[model samples]
Target chain A: MGLNTRIEAAISNAVKVGQAKFPDNSGAVPPRLASALAYATAPGGARIRPTILTSVAMACGDDKPMLADAAASALELIHCASLVHDDLPCFDDADTRRGKPTVHLAYSEPLAVLTGDSLIVLAFEILARQSSHAPDRVAQMIVTLAQRTGMPGGICAGQGWESEAQIDLSAYHQAKTGALFIAATQMGAIAAGQEAEPWFELGARIGEAFQVADDLRDALYDADTLGKPAGQDDLHGRPNAVTLLGVQGAIQRLKDILGGAISSIPSCPGEAQLAEMVRMYAERLTPVVSPQSVPGE
Target chain B: MGLNTRIEAAISNAVKVGQAKFPDNSGAVPPRLASALAYATAPGGARIRPTILTSVAMACGDDKPMLADAAASALELIHCASLVHDDLPCFDDADTRRGKPTVHLAYSEPLAVLTGDSLIVLAFEILARQSSHAPDRVAQMIVTLAQRTGMPGGICAGQGWESEAQIDLSAYHQAKTGALFIAATQMGAIAAGQEAEPWFELGARIGEAFQVADDLRDALYDADTLGKPAGQDDLHGRPNAVTLLGVQGAIQRLKDILGGAISSIPSCPGEAQLAEMVRMYAERLTPVVSPQSVPGE
Candidate 1:
C-alpha cells in the first residue's frame, strides 16, 4: 500500500482504538472528550511527521510493520495533542485548526486541556502496546517520546519558553518544532532495529525546514489559504524565522535546510527513495499560485 | 534505611532529577516552571501511595532498588501532576493544597497546566530511563501508568465523569482515587518481577478505602485540619461517600473497606509483613486527634 494510505488507515485505526477504549460498558464517554480527540486527529494535515517517520523506517528496512505504524500513529497523536493545547485561550487562543474549530473552541477549555493530557498518555500507551514484541525498542521509544514531549528539552519546554522574559530562537524552535521530528526519525529507526543516533541530523534539518516553511506561510498567507489563523507569530510576539530573517531570507533558509535534510539522510538501502521523499516535501513547502486564483486572470 | 526515609529520599531525588534536567546551557528553564514542578511535589502529604508501592515491591522480593524507587517516584509524580491540574481554576478552583498555595495560585494558570503536563511526561521518562535493567518491566509500567492516567478507565476518565450530567459514585471513586493506588500496586509488582494481576484487588480495595477515608475527612474535618478546603464534595456538588451514605455510614464503609484491604493482600513470601503494613494503614485511616488536643483536657 502507498505510504499515505497506510498512514490514513493507521490513524483511523488508532482513533478507533481511542474511541472504543474511551467509553465504558454502558457506552459512556464524555462526548466532548471523545469528539475532541477524534476531531483533533481526523482528516490530518499533510501527515508530514508520520510520513517522515515511515520513510525512515522503510529506508531502514522495516521488519516490524505493526510497530512502524504504531510509531507513526503515536507521533501524530502527540502532534495533535500539541495543537490542541497550543490553541487554548491562554496560548494561541486560535479558534480554528486544520480548517475546523479547535478543540477548545469546539469543546470547553477544561475538556480541551483534559483531551490534550489524555492524548499524550494515549500516544505512549499505543507505543508501549505495540512494542510488546520488541521490549527494548518500546522502552527506547517511550523515553524518546517522553523526553521530546516533556522537559529538559521537549515541546513542553518549547511552550514554556513563551512565558519566559527572553527567548533563544534556536533552542525555542528546536524544542517547539524539532523535538517531534527527532522523535519520529529516532522512533522509526528504533522500530526498524536501526541505530537512531545517525538519523537525528536528518530529522533536525527537516524540522528546521518545516518551521521555516510554517513561518513563511504564517507571514504570507491568509487564514483561508492556511486553513488556520495566520500571522499568529507576530500577533503573539513570539519568535519566527520570517520576522527575524525577512521573507526572502526565510524562504532561502528553508530551501537550504531542505537541501541539508536530503543530504543528511543516513546511509541505508532506501536512501534514494528517502531523498526523493524529502524533495517532494520541499516542493510542497514552496509557495505555489494556482491559475484560477490569479487576481487579474 | 527506613521505608519512610527511603520514600522521602526518593521523592527528593526525583525532584532533583526534574530540576537538573529542566535547564539548558543558559541554565534557564522558565524559572516558574521549574519551581512549580519542584514545589508541587515537595512537602508531600502522607506519601501513602509510594509507601504502598514500595511495600508491594518489597513483598514481591525486589532486587533492583533503583528501579523500584523509579517506579515509586513515577507514580508519585503522576499523582502530583493530577493534584496540580485538579486544583486549576476550571476544575476544583482550589486555592490551597497541603496547607500551601496551589501551583496555579503560586505560579500562574498557564504555568500550572504546563507543569502538570511536564511532570506526567517526566514520570514516564524517569521510569524508562531507570528501567534499563528490565526492558519488559519498564514497558509494562509505562502501559500501566498510561492506562491509569489516561482514558476510558483512567484518572482522566474519572475526572471526565465530573463534567458529565450524570455521575456514578463507584466509577467516580474508583478512577479519581483508585486508579493511582492500582497503579502503585501494579507497578510495584511489575518492578519486583511478579505478576501484577494478583495485586489489583488489593490495590482496588486499598483505593476504595482511601477514598472513603477522604470522604470522611472532607465531610468532618475543618480546612485547618485537612490542610485544604473541607467539604469540597458538597461545595462542588460532586458525588461522595459521605453525601451518599452519610458521615457515620461513610466512616463505617471506610472501616469495612480497610478490613477488606487487610484480607486482600496477595500471597507472597512477605505476606505477613505486608498484612502488618496494611493494618498500620488501617489504624491511620480510622483517624484520631492528637493527645494534646483531647476535648476534656
Candidate 2:
C-alpha cells in the first residue's frame, strides 16, 4: 500500500487502541463523560502528528508494531487532551469540533474537564506501560512529553503566553504548535532507539510550517473544507503568521520551512517516503483551483 | 519543632514552592486564561498532601530541602489540578473552595478547564525537571505519579467509578485518596534511595484512616469549622463509611487503620519521629471537643 494509505490505517488502529483503553461508557454513573472522551477521540482526523511520529520511527530503522503503536498512541492522546481543553467555555468555547459538537457542548463542562484530565494522565500511563523501548528511552519520552505539555516551552506555556507577554509571532507559533510536533518526532526516533536531536529540530520546523499553513487556511478557507470553525484567530484577536507576514509572505515562509524540514531528515531506510509526505502536506496547504478538489480530498 | 508544627511548616514550604514555580499568570493571546490559572492555583488550601510527601521523604532518611521541596511541590500541583476539575459545573459544581470561589466560579468555565489542564502538565514538569534524584528514580516517580493520577487504579478511575460503578467504600477510598498517599510515601523513599513497598502500604493505610476521618467530619462537623460546605457526600449520594459502617464503627475503623499504619513503618533512623507524627495525627482524629481542633483549625 501507498504511504498515505498506510498512515491512514495506522491512525485508525491508533484510534481503536485509544478508545478500547478508555473506561467502559455503558456503565451507570454517567456515560456522558466517557462518551465525551470517546467522542472527542473518535472520528479520527488527518492524524498528522502520529503519522510523523511513526514515520520518524520507521526512518530510524524500527518498524516494530509495538513501538510504533505506543509512540503514535501517546501523541494522539496529548492531541486529544489539548483539543478537549481548548474547547472549554473558558478557552475557545467551541460548540463544534470535526463536524460534531465539541466535548463540553455534547456533555457538560465538568465532564469535559475531567475527560481532558483523564486523557492527559492516560497519555503518560500508556507511554510508561506500553512502550517497547528501553526504560531509559521511555523515561526520556515521558519527560519530554511532560515538559512540552507544561511550562516555559510547552503547550501550557504556549497557551499562557498569549495573556502574559508581547510575544513574537514565531516564538508563539514555536511554543503553541512546534512543541508537540517536536515531541512527536523525537519520541518516534527515541522509540526506535535513535538519538532525537536532529529529528526534533526537523519536526519543530515542520510544525512551524504547518502552523503557518493553518493560519493561512483559517483566513482563506471555509469551515466546510477545514472541518471546523475557520476565521477564529481574528475573532479571538490572536496574532498569526497571516497577521504578521501577510498571506503571500506566510505562504512563502511555509514553503521554505517545509523544504528545510524535509532536508533536515537524515538519509535512512524510509527517508524518501518521509520527505515525500512532507512535500505532499505542503502542497495540500495551497489554495485549490476547484474548491472541493483539495489534495487530501 | 513538634511534629504537628513541623508538618505545618513543610506544608507551607511546599505551597510556596508550587506558587513560585508558576508565577506567570498571563496567556499568550488571551490574558484572561492565564489570570484564571493563577487565581485557581495561587490561593490554595492547606498543603496537606505535600506535607505528607515531605514527611515521608524525611522519614525515609533524605531530608534535603531540594528533594523534599520538589516532591512536595509536585504533589500539591497534582492536588490543585484535581480540585480544579472536581469543582467544575459538570463535576461537583462547587462555587467555593478554601474560603474562596473556585476557578470556574472566578473565571469562565473554559479558562478554568485550561487552568486545570495546565496544572496537571505542570505537575509532571516539576517532577521531570526539579527532582533531585537519579534519572531512573525520576522516571519511576513519574510513572508512579501518572499511574495514581490516571485510570484503573488511580484518581481518574475513582472519579470514573463515581459515575459508573457501585464502588465499595474501600476501593473508592483506595483509588481516590490512598493512591496519592501511597505515591507520597513512595516518592519519599525513592528520593532517599530506599525501598518503597513498606512505606507504600503504610501510607495507604494512613490515607484510608484520613479519608474516614474526613467523612466523619463531613457528617458530624459544621460548615463554619470545616470552612467549605459540609455534608457534600450526603448531597451527592456518595456511600461514605459513616453511612455504610455507621458513625461509631467508622470511628473505630479509623483508629484501627491509623494504628496499623503506624505499626507498618519499618524501623529506621527516623522511625521514632514518623511514629510520633502518626500517633499525633491519630489522636487528633479522636472526637474532638471542637471542630477547630482539627489540623487546619
Candidate 3:
C-alpha cells in the first residue's frame, strides 16, 4: 500500500482500539465520549507526522509493520489530543478546527477535556499493546512520547508558555509544535531498531520548518482557507515568526530550515527516499498567492 | 523504612523525575508550569492509593524497590491528576482542594487543564523509566494505568458518565473511583510478577467501600472539616450513594462492603496482613462527630 493509505489504516485501527476499549460489558460510557474521540481523530489531515515516522522506520531497515503502525498511531493521537485541548475556551478559544466546530463546541467543555485526556492515555495503551516484539523498544517509545507530551518541556509546557509575561519564541515553538515532530522521527528510528539520537536533529529541523510555514499561513491566510482560525498568534498577542520577521523573512527562514532538514537525514539505505520525502514536504510548505491576494487587475 | 516514609520518598522521587524531564535547556518552560505541577502533587492527602499499592506489592514478594515505588507513584499521580481536573470550572468548579485553592484558582484554568494533562502523562513516563527490570512488566503496568485512567471504563469515562442524561450508579462509582483502586491492586501484583486478574475483586470491593466512605463524609461533614466543599454531589445534581441510599442506608452499605472487603482478599502470602489493613481502614471509614456538627444536637 502507498504511504498515505497505510497511514490512514493505522490511524483507523488505533481509533478502533480506543473506542473498543471503552464501553465494554461493564456499564459503557455515555456514547458521547466515544463518539467525540472518534470525531477528533477521524477525517484526519495530511497524516504528515505519521508519514514521516513510517518513512523513517522503513529507511532505518526496520520492517516491523505492527510496531511501526502503532508508533505512528500513538504520535498522531497525541497530536490530535493537543489540538482538542488547545481549542478549549481556556486556551485558543477556537470555534472551528479542520473546518468543523471544535470538539468543545460540539461537546461540552468537560467532555472535551475528558476526550483529550482519554486520547493521550489511549496512545500509550496502543503502543504497549503493539510492542510485544521488543519490550525494551516499547519502553523507550513510551518514554519518548510521554516526554514530548508532558512537562517540564513537553507540549503542555508549550501551552503554559503562552500564559507567561515573557516568552522565548524558540522554546515555545519547539515544545508547542516541534516536540511531536521530534517524537515522530525518533520513535520511527527506535521502532526500527536504530539509535534514536542521530535522527533528532533532522526532526528538529523539520519541525522548525513546519512552524515557520505555519506562521506564514497564520499571517497570510484567512480562517476560511486555513480551515481553522488564522492570525491566532496575533489575536492572542503571542509571538510568531512573521511578527518577529516579516512575511518575506519568514518564508526565507522556512526555506533555509527545510534545506537543512534534507541535508541532515541520517545515512541509511532509505536516505535518498527520506530526502525525497523532505523535498516534497518543503514544496507543500512553500506558500503561493491565493486569488484573493492578487493585485487589482 | 516504614511504609509511610517509603511512600513519601517514592512520591518525591517521582515528582523529581517528572520535573527534570521538562525544561531540558531548550529554554525551560515558564517556571509557573513546573511549580503548578509540583504544587498540585505536594502535601498530598492520605497517599491512600500508593500506600495500598505498595503494601500489596510487599505482600506479593516483589522486593524490587524501584519498580514497586514507580508503580505506586504512577497510580498516585493519576489520582492527583483527576483531582486537578475535577476541580476545574468546567467540572466541579470548586475553589479549594486538599485545603488549598484549586489548581485553576491558584494558577489559571488553562494551567490546571495542562497540569492535569502533564501529570497523567508523567504517570506513564515514571513507570516506563523506572521499570527496567522487566520490560514486559513495565508494559503491563502502563496498560493497567491507562485502562484505569482512560476509557472503556477508566476515570475519564467516569467523568464522562456525569455528562450523560441517565447514569448507572454502580458503573459510575466504579469508573470514577474504583478504577484507580483496581489499578493499584492489579499493578502491585503485576509489579511483583503475579497475574493481575486474581486481585480484581479485591480492588473493586475496596474501591466501593472507599466511595461509600466518601459519600458518608460528604453528607455528614462540613467544608472545613472535609477540607473541600461538601454536598458537591447535590450541588451538581450528580448521582451519589447518599442521595440514592440515604444516610443511614449508605452507612449500613459501607459497613457491609468493608466487611466483604476483608473476606475478598485473594489467597497470597500477604493475605492476613491485607485483611488487617482493610480492617484498620474500615475503622477509619467509620466516622465520628466533629465539633462543627454539634450545632443541631
Candidate 4:
C-alpha cells in the first residue's frame, strides 16, 4: 500500500484502539470525564508518528498489528496529554484544538489536568500490557517514554524551559517534539524484536528533521491548514529554528537534516522501504508556504 | 527496631532513593524544568504511604529496602499527582496543600499540570526500572497501578464521578481513597515474594477505616490541625460515609471496619509485629465522644 493509505489505516486503527481502550463510560470515571477523554482522543489527526512507528516495524519484518496498536495508542496518549497541558491558561492558553475547544476549555481545568495525568499513565499501561513484545523490551520502552515525558529531557522540561532559560533552539525542539518522535521509531523497532540501536541515530535525525518542518510550518503556515494556531511560537517569544535562521536558512537546514536521516538508515533487510518513507515526508514538508509569504498580499 | 521506627527508616530510605532518582539539572532536561521538578518532588510530606508499604514488606519478611523503594515511590508519585490535580481551579480550587501553596498556586497552572503528568509517568518509570523484581511481578504492579490511576476504579474516576451521578459513598471512597491504600498493601506483599490476594481485603478495610477517620477529621478538626481546609467535602455536597451514616453511626462503622481489617491479616509466619501495628491503629480510632458531640463545632 502507498504510504498515505498506510497512514490513513494506521490512524483509523489508532482511533479504534483508543476507543476500545477508553469507552464512553468506563465504570469508574464519571460520564463527563470519560466523554472528555473520548472527545480528546477520537478526532483523527495527521497520525504521522504512528505511521512512522508502524512503517518502521513493518520494515523490520514484523507485521503484528498489535504492536502498531500499542505504539500508536501510546504516542497519541502522549500527544493528547501534551496538548491538554499546553492549552491550560498558564501555557499557550489556547481555546481550541483540532477545531474543537481544548480540554481545559471544554472540560473544567481540574478534569483537564486529571485527563492529561491519566493519559500519561495509560500510555505506560498500554506498553506494559502488550504481550507481543518481551517483558524486558516493554519495560525499556516504558522507561524511554517516561524519560521523554518527565522533568529532564522530556516534554515537561521542554515546556518548563521556555519560562526561564535562554534555551538553544535545537535543544528546545528536540526535547519538546523530537524526543517523542525518536521514541516512536525506537519503540517500533523494539517491538519488532530488532536491534534498535542501529536505527536510533536515524530516528533522532528524522525526528529533528520533522521538528524543523514543524518550525517552518509554525513560521509560515496558516492556522486553518495546520488545524491549530500558527505563528504563536514567534509571538510568545519561544525559541525556534526559523527565528534563529531566516526562512530560507531553516528550509535548507531541514533538507540537510532530512538527507542525514535518510542516509543513516542501515542496510538492513527492509531499509529501502524505510528510506523511501523518509524521503516522502521530506518532500511533503518542502513545499508548504510560510505565513510570511503572504503578509499584506 | 520497633515497627514504627523500622517503617520510618524505610520511608527515609525511599525518600533518599526518590531524591537521588530525580536529580536537579540533569542534562536531559532544560534547567528550568529540572528545577521545577526538583522543587515539586523535594522531600517534606509525612511519607505515610511509603512507610506503610515498607512496613508491610518487612512485616511480610522482605527486608530489602530497595525492593520497597520502587513501590513506595510509585505510590507517592500517584498521591502527589492527585494532589496537584485536586488543587486546580476546576476541582477543590484550593490555594494550599500540606500547609503551602498548591502546585498550581505556586507555579502556573500549566506547569502544575505538566508536573503532575511527569509524576504519573515517573511512577511507572520507577516500576519498570526495578530489575530486581520478576518481570511478571513488575508488569503486574504496573497494571495494578495503572488500573487504580485510570478511569473506573482510580482516584481520577473517583473525582470524575463527583461531577455526575450521586455515587454511593462507599464506592466513591473506595475508588478515590482506598485504591491506593490497597495498592500499598498489595505491593508490599508482592515485594516480599508473597501472594497479594490474601492482603487485599485487609488493606481495603484499613483504607475504608482511614477514609472514615478522614471524614471525622474533616468534620471535627480545625484547618490548623488538619492542615487543609476544614469541612470542604461537606461544603462541596459530595457524598461521604459520615453524611450517609451520621456521626455516631460512622464512628461505630469505623470501629467495626478497623476490627475487620486487623482480623483479616493472615495467620502466617513473621506477622506478629504487623498484627500489633494493626491493633494499635484500631485502638487509636475508638470513639472518644458520644453522638451528642457536635461535628465541626
User: Which is the leading candidate under lDDT?
Assistant: 3
Q: Return the lDDT, model 1, position A231.
A: 86
lDDT of 1 at A20: 64
The RMSD (Cα, Å) of candidate 4 is 3.7
Residue lDDT tens for model 1, B123-197: 888888875698888888888888788876678878877777877666667777888999999999999999988
How displaced is residue B120 in candidate 2, in Å? 1.7
Give the number of the best model, judged by TM-score: 3
B281: Cα error in model 3, Å: 1.1
Chain B TM-score by candidate, in order shown: 0.93, 0.84, 0.94, 0.85
Q: What is the lDDT of residue A234 in candidate 2?
A: 91
lDDT (Cα, tens digit) per residue for candidate 4, span A104-140? 7788776787677667777777777774357777777
Chain B TM-score, model 2, reads 0.84
Candidate 3 global lDDT? 0.86
What TM-score goes with each of the models? 0.93, 0.81, 0.96, 0.89
Collision pairs in model 1? none
In angstroms, the error of model 4 at A85 is 1.8
Model 3 bad stretches (over 4 Å): A21-27, A290-297, B21-24, B289-297
lDDT of 2 at B179: 75
The prediction achieving the highest DockQ against the true structure is 3
Give Cα distance to truth, residue B49, candidate 1, Å. 1.0
* Cα lDDT of model 3 by residue, B1-297, tens digit: 899899889888877776774434554666788889889998999998998898889889976778889999899899999999999998889999989999999999999999999999999999999646888888998998888999878999888988888887677888988999899999999898888888888789889999888977887888998889998877888767877786667778988998887787788898899889888888888767465642233
Query: How high is the DockQ of candidate 3?
Result: 0.70
